[model samples]
Target: MNAFLKFMKRNYKIVALVVLLAGALFGFTMIPGQKENDPDKDKLLIELLTYVIEKGHYNPAAIDDTFSKGVYKDYLENIDPSKRFFTQADINEFSKYETQLDDQINNRDLSFFYLTYGRLQQRIKEANSFYKDILAKPFDFKADESFNTDYEKMPFAKDDAELRDRWRKQLKLSVLSSVADKEKMQDAPAEDKLKDKEKGFSDEKALEAKPGADVNKTKANGEKKSFTELEKEARESTLKSLNDYFDFVGDLKQEEWFSIYMNAIAERFDPHTYYFAPDDKDKFDTSMRGSLEGIGARLQKKNDFVEISELIPGGPAWRGKELEQGDLIMKVAQGKDQPVDISGMRLDDVVKKIKGPKGTEVRLTVKKVDGSVKTIAITREVVEIEETYAKSSIVKKGGKTYGVIYLPKFYIDFENQDNRDAAKDVAAEVDHLKAQGVDGIVMDLRDNGGGSLKTVVDIAGLFIEKGPVVQVRSRAEDGKPSDKPEVLTDNDPKVHYDGPLVVLINNFSASASEIFAAAIQDYNRGLILGSKQSYGKGTVQNIIDLNRFVRGSTFGNLGALKTTTQKFYRINGGSTQREGVKSDIIMPDKYSYIEIGERDSDNALPWDKIAQAPYKPFKNNFAPAIANSKKRIAESAEFKLMDENAKFLSERKDDNNYSLNIDKFKADAAKIEVAAKKFKALGKYNSNLTFDALPYEKEKFKNDPALAEKKKDWYESLGKDAYVNEALNVLDDLQPKGGKTASTEAKKETRIKTR
Candidate 1:
């Protein structure tokens, strides 16, 4: 869900144009005290969103019947994908507005949204009662029954009776599966259970147990219960899960649902354009800022109570030392104000109540682990999310130390330029690795769904001399590409780590990640190793604050819109929109045989080419290293198993029919177990490499035990990674034998003039 964002401050022309369009298109009465759910507010949102997209979007879709139909289908599927809530009668009634939505949107009509929303609420209420009634009695496992999970191909129920039957079958299938798991654990011998534990298998009974579940009825007590007892316990767990799900759904406000309808209209143009409500806008800002002012504690809903899941280290809650992880929060109060009961309240609403500005106090009434009720007060402060920043580890392989820097995203705090960013953090990491006397480095970008464009340019500049990083072209008023593409370059000539280098990527690496990889590949600065290709997202979006367009209104925050403003291409002139950036050394992964990139989206833009920018390729020849990695991959048994697993999953993608009959279901499951046994060793494969934290981080562990534990788990996971091991092997091959590395003697290339 990440995107490449270009700050509006850096693009003045686009901002000016958007402001002019807003001034010309909007002229409405400003209601100073309008209610939040007023229809006029929804109309204003629709009008404002459409105008922005039409004026700022790179290639806006025509709002005609075809566009309306796409929105209609997407909106329906998004609301109820399983076809459980809505019957055929409901669909038939909603079909009248399928082609009228485009006209309605132009007129700022809310008729269709109201009709569908009202019907869905009624169906949800009916379905809730149906589940409770169905779970009240025991299911007939002896009877032959089956459930097909291919909801897309299934037809809607014709009447209320058929809908109830559908609900019954779904619940029966769920209970049957849980019962089968319980039966397996009870039937297994003690030695077999220990063997399973050694293989990293979890305790199925413990995992399936919900909060406040009966201890005597579950496998946790090591009791061998009858089939009837296990079935009853499974049913109880399912009921609790459903109740919790409905509770969360029941808390969603009307404005939140309206945001979905707004996005349905925006996404027809492209997949990246989206509409963010006020709360969602705040969340997006917090994510980009990597810090928030609040009592830093993770909470989870347990039945009707909220439990403290974790206390973020170095935050106010953790520093208090009075609150524990298992404490159940019963009431919350602001300073000396009266406590408000939070029972059955939504988790997000509880979080909103607990979080406050820095130096503010919030008191919590919590039930302690020992059943003692106590009131505790904590002062809020800024809590930085440590996981958002870049981290590195050093490992010694074949007598050479190599540093692996993992960048989760190209993050930057847009509101404050002085805050830490990906470019600054990455440069610091390079300096740390050099101080550690490492022979080579690996820039791990797998699953990094991009961020700022400026950070990518700066990060790419770490290895190469001054040159073009990427080329971007905007759509003009005539719906044609700009005459000349703007070439973004890194002007610095100094190389941070000029020695042997490798950049690792996978199917989830996108946007700015692709830009960095493409720059490295184009300059021949490093070998791109991992999946066949990265995620094919080449579009750039800018967040437009919607409040700026409104003159004077008490509608509160109008939120913001993220619209696609331009498309980016690689310096080689080829668009990475659909093709992404191909790896120099292709690696086998679990998703290798599946379609999961931007190309999988039907609304994605088409791939094209532009004039290539002039730049010099490094003299370093990676052919020998690439050839060696290919040879190793061909002979490795672990990779071969992964490839086989990928093919097995691809073949089973459409096999959604599941048997509800106990005997038949067990037989079907045994066949799958036998087939999946070959891939079990892939999980246990270990590289046997030793990865350690740098000296500075290790020193901090003396006072921070949580940080120590987190890094310990990270190092353990890295030691088991086969992909990281192979990347180290490639870096070993790239090491200079009798002279300096290839990049040391490379000459800089001159920048090409714009057309």
Candidate 2:
């Protein structure tokens, strides 16, 4: 409460008057124990959160004003990520309590929250009018204006007029895409709309078309959409989007906002330490359940649109092969019902619309990467965990077959030990591939975010004889490692699939993936190749149900806290906390130049080293293999194209200065389109690597032609993967014609370069 004291000293009279008023409003409670409409449960929750964060967090920050400042910043940023809502005056008014939040949190005071919430409500109402007023009049397309999307670089509006102007510019930028599409419509040749006028639009996205007016009127007639007509459509669309967004926002209760505030406080300890509300916990469980009756696309909110981040393999969407990743879902329909536009819908709400009972049909209108909209329908099924788990395929090149396995995540069923774990399942896959008589193994851990720590050791044991794989260090009362470092290892001496190995990783490979990759690299057990490094997530978390800590409370659903408890260190002293696992032979890809690792995260723990864990290093023949692979990557056209793609994307990402003027916007859009085409060639790269499903899968698919087609497409994509082809070439270089392990070779010490 040093900040409180300092403020009081500077303006004692003002502070005392404000305190008296705040006290009067807060049920005039002298003890700060109770409030109007706020139950004791919430107070208990606050106390519990503070206590758990302080005692349970691996390295808790001091709960002072400095910490309070961090919470203040986090809370404001969470609420205003784009700096589009609050103005300078609003920020100034809220800044008064910037330092006093620590005292308030400790005092169990929520007056500051009420104050900010009330102001935000007022500001939102103000913004609603601002956009409506701007959209009411015609926007001058010929006006020379530019919008800067680097929100960090933009200042808050100085006044209401400036705020309205800011809204006008933003709204113009938002409609640029629709305006450009309208222009394209103006340029297109007339279509035979009479032949197919609304013929196939029965299951299309719901549109607010005028009664008896042809929805495809533009396509039917040679006449183009007038500028005024485009303007009306764009403005109405924006208004609807804003209204829907506000409607969604209106559904959230004060408890949710308080949860955000509390989370902001908790995150000062670390990024991973999070408070999961009851609903959030349920959603987490659903996601972790691995299989659900859905279309099976991972959706992420990108502004107003819900973009497909991933298509779960073997799911309905993947089987259809029509819906790809990076597609933006605009609308969702169920059983031929009038489609509901899902843009501006909450992600959870959108997911609910897409998922249904197994065998139900769902239609989606998605905007593809090429800026074309298409409708895709799929019969939903229960996507199994097996699709996400270890699956091996044979890749043949130069008359040699190599085993390739892709581990999506180190998955584990927390509620059931009988459920398949990554380590066990992967080891089983290894035995199966060995049975196929594969010469070498290429384990793909790209995009694997990791799972159970016990599983990490188990999986590590499959490649090594017996040694410490990782060291766990915890925070103690003192400023040093309090607990003695526990080395997690496998005592099992049997090594499964001890052949020429190449572990494929990317920037997205993290946590348990990093642990396994680091172990392989540390022991020189295999050649690590992909992005420069893996996702450096070396910390561990334990979910603590808050209900277990409290008793005899009438309160329901106390929820849980996923708190960071420890950090994992590689055998040779380096913690993969931030630096991640380095690849022996780096290959360029899309995320090569992106800040996607744990190091980019706010409040992330710093990288450090502990005493080395004693272990016997394995001998590997990756030196010449890495050299040869590097030479191939340097010479290959696909690799050069990929490098260029990475640079182009990085440049685009860095250039956030967007033009609001039509000509400039069109010019930038054209440049982006051309650049996007160049990267498209990377997807078409074929290494002539042939892949075959396992015998069991092959036999099973024989009875199901649909499933067989899905498998065929997946294997063919593996054939097109240039990275996988290079990985196989590296394996060939490592294990000559005999195709055997070099484990019998003399052990040589190799120090990995630290970033």
Candidate 3:
């Protein structure tokens, strides 16, 4: 799922007005009937972006040497991620524009882009030839060499010979890994071999596996090939993989490359601000709407094959149950039509072939997890990403039924408010839980990356009585925060559910998530539980249609720009920018000791404070629950193991060197496996809690088995979650002594103060 720091629809008009004014003043109108790859379009885009960002961005960065260098470094890295292609000479020649990009952008110059794009094409062609020759023969993995994969720090090749050696080393590492895996597979037991089929072995993966190849499948599978033969087969496999990669790369158009360059400039303002191309803008809209009219399976390029990465729950592919994750798609065909092989095809092109209008049928020839090929036909339909919406489960623990609602994001349909949104769905779930006699509720916001700001306020309203939910500050025309922060409040005085509450969060919970958690903590309406803090993304972005500014322009889709327009603050006056909402009951997690979130980003906005909004805290005390949870966490062996694992991960996070020698590589891997085995019990822990769908949802399972399966999996996962168990225990402690409205005033109040 994609998470964005988007503002409410109400704020769009303000930003749009600013952009419209800037566009009129700048005169971005273009002549109609411009040819493709028009230099005029590029110049207009540069002018439009700079003007819009300066007019609308919350904190626009200065277009100086620093910004120019960042764009230069990021653009180069984006083009050649692996440090392959582009020799030292190329870098030297391009370095001239490192500090001049600022000047070039100001003048609407394309010299830097033109030079780099042309040089990249030449290098790519050269490297394509280099790989074919490098993989023509077996690699000598017996050499005791190591490859340092810190490509960012790795020096570029000085000459053609050095560049060729670089390619040789990279290709050798790939082939060596495959050879080692094949050797182990040959030695593995039949049962182990059967289990390994999940890794997949598509036909396009190797010419040696083809029917007429000298080393056919029968001989390769049944017989133990010598090291020489295995190495040969691996080289062939590596060769095919590279062929597919270059083939995909060759399909890249100038527009695609230009999009990358444009984003490099946009991201200099902040990590979240982006320039979405025409097609990508449509994708962003589809994701925000949480529905797509097509086959609902996510595909990714796996070597030469397109593999099913995930099947969207409740969608046609998921309902069909024929297509599973890890299955490699070989071919696609329309209803009753001949299947077209998609091997070595670009992923976007393949997706176009697979997706169709609703009610149309598409047949897929996929290599299943069991290495068996099968053709399955699935009808295209309007697939709502079930996981993106709010869902609740009934948790039976200690003779008390509590509800756990997992919200992946604060999704909404801006164009259609009547359609389901996270706020509406969550309110409904709360109503359902109350009907089922749930004594408490756990709002799971783990890994949520934020969405509609309006939804966060609405959802927060469900827990507490009428109050200020959050504070928002828009940037003034001078690119400074406004004098008065707007306090967004819940106008409704009705509290939907006033029972014991707990909000679960992690380092990945961001933006709107931080706002919700902060409101709950600030109001003393719930105990914020989970990792050290939520992701600190307090900035709000609004998408501006760039095409709107250009009147009567046939430049072919000017696309859209998402730029930071405002910064939100907790009702308590603190911005969750780099300092996300702190958890009341901190739990041990793998990311606890590691740096992540907005603080880790290079261009993230700074944290600050605003005047606190006027709101009274709920008269509920959560001290006893927090103390009990901390005590349980400190005493439990499960938590102790998790803490140790977190430390272990922190220590090894920077280890990037890997041995090329098979024996050394295997020994290092075994050592890691042994060290990792110490924490294996973490995955096996069972909280002994039974989770089930409510009666309303269970009734619908008869007609939709996919829903039943999804719920079953959710319950199974909940059963293994130690964090949920702790949350439930905290809920137990939070249960009011007299009743739901009981006064804890005499309980010697102990409160966890929030910023």
Candidate 4:
């Protein structure tokens, strides 16, 4: 359900409150010495996780030999991403449990965990030793060799020499980018240097010191180091990286590994049925809380390093104006303390260090978007994740102003119904835009992974004089009162600002977003645009706190499991599961050709349909809007370039094997870089769209420079959005003759703002 991407925006809070409410009503005092860390909790956890999966999951697969083998396969791939850790002999030995994990779980045995953990320890030790040995010798950058970054193409090494060669080639590739960057830095002007000289010490010295090498050596001529020396530094960097990997691995406990094993088992059922450890559960809750007392940045792990994916608008990080997407977090420090190198740290562990009580300050050594590094300080505060809520602005085109509501998620506070929600926020924004005499409205739901189901129903009702919006089908179960498919209708006869409407969606729009989009499309209430389809995630999940199931025991903190409980269906008798909501006008984007969404997921629910909900479709459906958009989109050069870029990226992704030869590598990279230059013109493709913050936002922006900058960036991006530009064309075409509510047989076209 795009759960990974929507963690902070939606899902989390809904899940947490559901459990928190359940716990508060049912929980008893914990037994003395029986807290989550109790020794007996491991077996208890397995008992709980297994019970939940079997009893509560919508469709739990049999934990037979096939399932056990699947778990074994997933474990190997994730634990050793490169497939270099274990040999054929080791695999053969471990294959004994390939079909026994199911039985082991049933018996409450930790033998499999014990065996794998022990063997993995030996492998990591041996692999680190091999990496060190490989680093001891100089690598020939010009050597005619190649490595496959795609691990699926690789098998376990045949023997030790083959394993060492595998390690050697991979390590060489690891340092290639660093070496290239260093080369670029050396030739570039000193004024273009990314980092200041000696914030602490040189990288090479740190690497050598880790391996007991003295760092007192001086350059013989005190001249600039040659390419050869630079390559040496790159290789050393790779070694230090490997050392960090091993160091991080050394701290892995049995419980953590077992949780990974459990997750592997759960993932076999579905992608989103995750098993969170206690610490991870805590983090999940914090994310669901929405605003945390921290720097307020969304971070993601990119390979071995953590990179800032986004900054919560109006947060300390955004206000500080230092962090940006793609910036690598090199180190983290508190106050004047020595900064801890977090280059290879766990994402959650690193998060714990950065986030703190409100008012505390944390300093980050950030590698900026331009490869420049700087030390910046941010005072942690209660950072409101405003972007996760509904926000709107006005866009002017063709001498007419249109409303654009960017609803990031279908957010709602289940614990507190009175809390602000997407439905209410959007309703207010729509009224505001209507008051401004907007000719048309564009609702941007791109990257919206969805949130509250109740919010979806409410938001959907705003478009049409409402009937059924979505259908929910629940599998018949023991003790369940209803097993039939049910249609949820919006009883409120309200159509707020029903002027020409447009919805923008992409591969990331899923779950509740899909429901909303499907309803709008099904009802013919709006013109849908963007990618060929929205992310198909029609299933629903329920988070179960395992602690509740094991009452009267001291083994609390059994964590929780989110299981698929039901499937959502559209009112038009179609399932938005694997086959997502099709756009009225299929536009091309970078993700158009990517294998994402429910179809990419293993064991995702199949697309099926129940009886269509009876509802009236729009008579003046603005079917012409689709044709108009398609015409304009076909003529858009930026869209054509985007399709070409998608093709290039698809071909590039399939070409996984890469040359190790320096000359060949550079040639290939340059070829791709040059081809990428074609996309630079994308930003210049203006829609001639002028935007203004709503009156309320306009007033706030006067006192909030950061707010002004955020809106400014958003406005400029809209101008460059060829898809949105086409949507604007669609909007213009669909608007009524006098810029009133779009003409329909209902003749309901009044200066309507139905509440």
Candidate 5:
């Protein structure tokens, strides 16, 4: 049996007895009081409340403020008929409340529920009104364009006149859409006019093969095509494109329209969470499982254009080496054919056009960063990019080597049993590094958004002796703790390494990553170094089956609900809520310009504490190590240069407004170039004077080779890592012996000379 089951059996008997007595008293009142009741109202309230409570995973008492007791009971019956959380005996004891349900209803205060319900109802009504208006007089696409361009400001238009003016513009656009459709019908060829059939003429070829077409006046040396013929062909091609768009829109269903609206609202919440329709559920599952057949690129809409944001490192696109960041996708074709123009298209429509079954060919016409155009062909396939996985490299400095492991994200292949798990893989890496005889290790978890909870516990266990990893507390339903702290295991008692360790985290480090870092800090197992704090996300969500809460006889699928079920607290009782893990040493980052972490987010859960768990601390003192590191970094030329670059980036972020004039742009570019050169020169003068400037040239820098090299060096330096350098210095200070090594003495001399 599980620990939860054990707890329930041990304490539930007393709680059930108390609830039974209350139910009996409540039931007695139902017999005496007589008043007319709206049976439908009671039933409706119960249905809504029950579905929400069981699936919502909130406190049962919350229902009192949002619904009546009788309604609550109805919801309980529908939601938990099998009494998985509460036994049948407990339910029988509570049946007495059914008799006095009306009396308990009088005590209910559902203000919050009413408000939320009212808002939902209002949105539905507004949507209905818009639908009816559109049906009566369809949207005019042309006029809507003007208003849509400034639609963001419409919300703050101040007066009815301004709002009406904006609406008028929108109405005009709707009329234009209708006009465009009419024009398309008149211009389309007889066979191609049908929505199902494609136009016979290739868009590009049609422009060259029109009536009165002019043959080239000259050869490739100085060729010229007939302008009049080309113009006519272009017009015909554009009309066909419009016809295709109309046909696509006409096929959309009412549910699809609503989905588009709902998606807009969900997007406003965040980029990740989405409301998937039944048809999209399969793809959703695949994405979460980290397996999908596509071009292996993450795309997003920016400034009304679909742009490729990230090329999955070992995916088809990355392997092809043609697709790159800032490349504008103008069109997508299934094979070696004239591509359909996707410019000025909706993001979803573009996505639909690109996604297809595995082994299918997809061609992308791309506009490169250098104003060059090229067509890249890629065969869709499952992309497993190991670049995102934890990878280790050795950094040798002053005769000692440190293993530098970079964990970009806490990823796992839950769907593929044969795949290597992240925690297991990382452990193996640690073992390998240990065998290589490295003196210390630097686990870089920067920008890791975290993943599987089980994996996090396993990773933490690798650093500490076995003990309770984290405590989870679910809101009590009937005045008692719902579950106890689940103690995770590391089974293997052997320590991977007994050497010094340093964990590097940043503002982007979150969830399971934060948990691992916190565990290490709480146990004093390693040196924590990086930004001020990490992304604080301490809530746990579980997928609940909605079929259990249906009102009818047969189970109807309403989709699964991922609701927050519990709060996770550190074993020491502190919650990683608004306050994520704090670093022992801070590093300057360009992202510092933007507000990051849970404290910066609205509606973030507050930090709290529970109770401490027993655990032993790792015997390492790092204060002196950090102090000495600070002294070294303050005088290091490379460190100073990095700091200057960080400040410049921050300034550029703050002053983003730029002139479009060629002269002004050139001048600004020149200024930036000068600054970069000075920063590089400083690095050369201070440390590694023999380091060549050729490696840091503009052409090399453009490809980010310098940044990549620096990052690698930073990780390898271990105690010499500017941040880790400080950490090691602090450790030295905390130790009985202070900085006494030849390397330390040499660094001290360099610091004095630089100062």
Candidate 6:
């Protein structure tokens, strides 16, 4: 049976949505009971349901049914807000289940509820059994033969069961080691050793080699201590270290175990999504808001050590030039001069040491890439979103300059009193580019995950005169439906730019990016070009404060729930959910192995259509312009090399298994190395520089060459990066000239069809 259905069947009674209206009518308005059926639950649930139905994976027809069932299933499986601190009697009450919960749910029988309650009781009984098992076991290392350095790596103990056994043995060994250490310390004759040292017998070698004192060969009671005996002592020392680690973990309480379980479940959803306890919510919110007062760098714990991953451009670290990606941070000091070594420390504890109030200084001692050590001081400050804002550069091609704006992400500072948003930044860029007499502008939204919905609509409005950008449909309580496009809300009548424009996107472009691209395509305002499609995350989420759902309490529930709320659609009637915006000119990308864009995600909103908003097309007679652009792109040597690299990667991905023979691996590695060398040569030519020979250092070449080749191919692939060349060619075609209109019109049509 499906996991969700099975859970629902067992706990239908407890999991059932008790209508808030019903609870209010019953006059159950006291603490726990009143809070359990508060109006906020219904409101939040409805809002989330509506959003999921409109923007979630299921078709509109299946959305309502799926969401209603799914939500109930979720509640049934995990809604035991009270920590399971049940008595022995509760465990006994839950042990009599005969049938699986699914059968009961499907049959709508009361037996299902009883069985579910019984199951919970049975789990508590199992917990008690586990406790007794631990208590009854002998806390001695000798009986547990698994106490060795290689215990964790042994093949016999591969699974969780074996690992647990190993942990138990290690714990016992740790206790024995501690006892031995105390015994050795107590027996130490401090006065005798001090007297011997004063008498010129201090050196361990000199004392052992004393005349008629062959200590190495001597044995107590005529028995020799062999080499094997010495080896055993060394092994015991290593095992003692392992035991110490296990002892610490084994001491956690049952409540901590439950918390760990909850955290693990949240991690299973996605890397970005997390389930935060009430205490962690504030920190989570602060991080997401991007206003944290700390040295602006993202770090990750790798191999039990923290390493810098990305430096937010213009942030403290970036400005100071003290930290770089791949640098290992060994220690962190907050205000105090004494530095604390963070090696092998928990990531949370390290973060606490680094993060502090604005204007406070933090010192980091990092190991640089060149084997040099450096101590750097950084002052924590509020990270400004403007530091990551969209900026444009003018690229001159064939004497014609074109504007290229790089938008990293659609960021919005919602908490700021003056919201200087992405849309505004982009508009300002467009104005700047237009004033420079640029022939055209290229809006690069590659790798942009998206941000505010309001910002997207505003950005889309800048290009189009005035029209609806997208449509949103939300679930209604009475099983009704509502839909409307998000139209341009820019009150200012002044236009930013009225020139040719092109949008560059890839698989990483999503949500707000999709909205903007779809709008431009619908209006035929400019060309959309890049990889196959964009990420199709079209649903919006509203954060519901659980405090509102708790009745008759000032503190209320301490957790907030983020629920899906609405689905966004393009004004042209098509939903950009599963069917993300498809570019006019497709490019090749290395991430083809990765299932990206909307349709790839499970449980994502499906594509649908609604009534199209009326809008006039931005007619441009630039057919010959595109054909001319394509011809240039096809002939570029840089593009050809990139295509070869992409083909190699695609071929590599298709091969399921690699040859196990060492010789075969080496040969393959060599061929890859040569290909990479060729790709680098191509880059050198593009920049008009002397190409250096391949760096064949064993460590560097082993993996670097393969990675370099992949990058080279990604850029060269036709559908992947034709935009850059196309943009350059497009600029050339748009140059004002005394040319024949008829020929230009024909060329434009041909290019459009081909693209």
Local accuracy by lDDT, each model: 0.78, 0.71, 0.76, 0.70, 0.50, 0.50
In lDDT terms, how accurate is model 6? 0.50
Model 3 residue pairs with clashes: none
lDDT of 3 by residue, 10-117 (tens): 366567667668665655456767776888899889988898888888889999999999999989887876577888999999999999999999999989998999
Q: For candidate 6, which ten residues in a row score worst on lDDT?
A: 205-214
Q: Which stretches of candidate 5 lie over 4 Å from their true place?
A: 1-50, 53-55, 58-253, 256-274, 287-382, 385-389, 408-419, 479-484, 489-493, 551-557, 631-755
lDDT of 1 at 68: 95
- Candidates in order: C-alpha RMSD to true structure: 8.8, 9.6, 7.0, 7.1, 15.4, 16.3
Q: What are the per-residue Cα lDDT tens digits for candidate 4 across 1-755?
A: 32222323333444444455455443554446854334357766776677666656666778888888888888777666567788877788888999998898788887777777788888888887778888887778778888776666778888778888887787776556445545545554555443322122221111111211111122467455677776677666556655665787788776776777777777888876878777667675665343346887777554335777556655777655556545677667675443555743566877887888888767776654332345666788886566457888898788888988988778888789898888999999999998999888899988677887778888998888858888776544452313466677787886776678889998768889999999988877887888889878888887777766545766546777877766788998888999898898889986666676688766676787777888877767566777777777678777889888777666655565667788887677677668777876765677676777889888988899876887787777677677777778888888776545663433353224222
* Model 1: residues with Cα > 4 Å off, grouped in runs: 1-12, 31-37, 188-222, 244-254, 283-387, 413-419, 435-437, 475-481, 554-556, 693-712, 745-755
- In candidate 2, position 616 carries an lDDT of 67
Residue-by-residue lDDT tens digits, candidate 1, 291-407:
245777767543345777555545667556567655777667676443455654555667788887898878776754433345567788886578557989999999899999989
Candidate 1 least-lDDT 10 residues: 203-212
Candidates 1 and 2 compared by lDDT, better number: 1
**Candidate 6 regions off by >4 Å?**
1-276, 289-385, 411-419, 479-493, 553-556, 621-726, 734-755
Please identify model 2 stretches exceeding 4 Å from their true place: 1-42, 185-223, 287-291, 295-311, 316-347, 353-382, 412-418, 475-480, 736-740, 746-755
Q: Give the TM-score of candidate 4.
A: 0.82
Q: How good is model 5 by TM-score? A: 0.55
Model 5 Cα shift for residue 487 (angstroms): 4.0
Off by over 4 Å in 4: 1-41, 189-224, 287-347, 353-384, 415-418, 479-483, 551-556, 702-706, 738-740, 743-755
After TM-score superposition, what is the CA distance of residue 470 in candidate 3 from its true location, in Å? 0.8
lDDT of 5 by residue, 1-755 (tens): 64434433433343333334434332321123322332333232334333333333423233332233434343343222212123334345445554444344333433323332333344333333443232343232222123232221223333434534443443333333222223333455556444312211111111111111111222265433343333333334334443453445445443333333233222222222233433445444544333234787766543334677556644667556567645667666664343565643555667776777888777776644333344567788776554556666654445555566767666676689678688887887787777666667778886576777667777777766666666667656454445555544445555555566778887767778888888888877777888778877776644433333333412122343344445667777788876888887666544444455567644345577877776655545566666666677668666666677666655543332222232343355456557656654532332221111222233544787744564343333333345544433343343333424322333345446658
Model 2 Cα shift for residue 538 (angstroms): 1.1
Question: What's the TM-score of every candidate structure?
Answer: 0.80, 0.83, 0.83, 0.82, 0.55, 0.55
lDDT of 5: 0.50
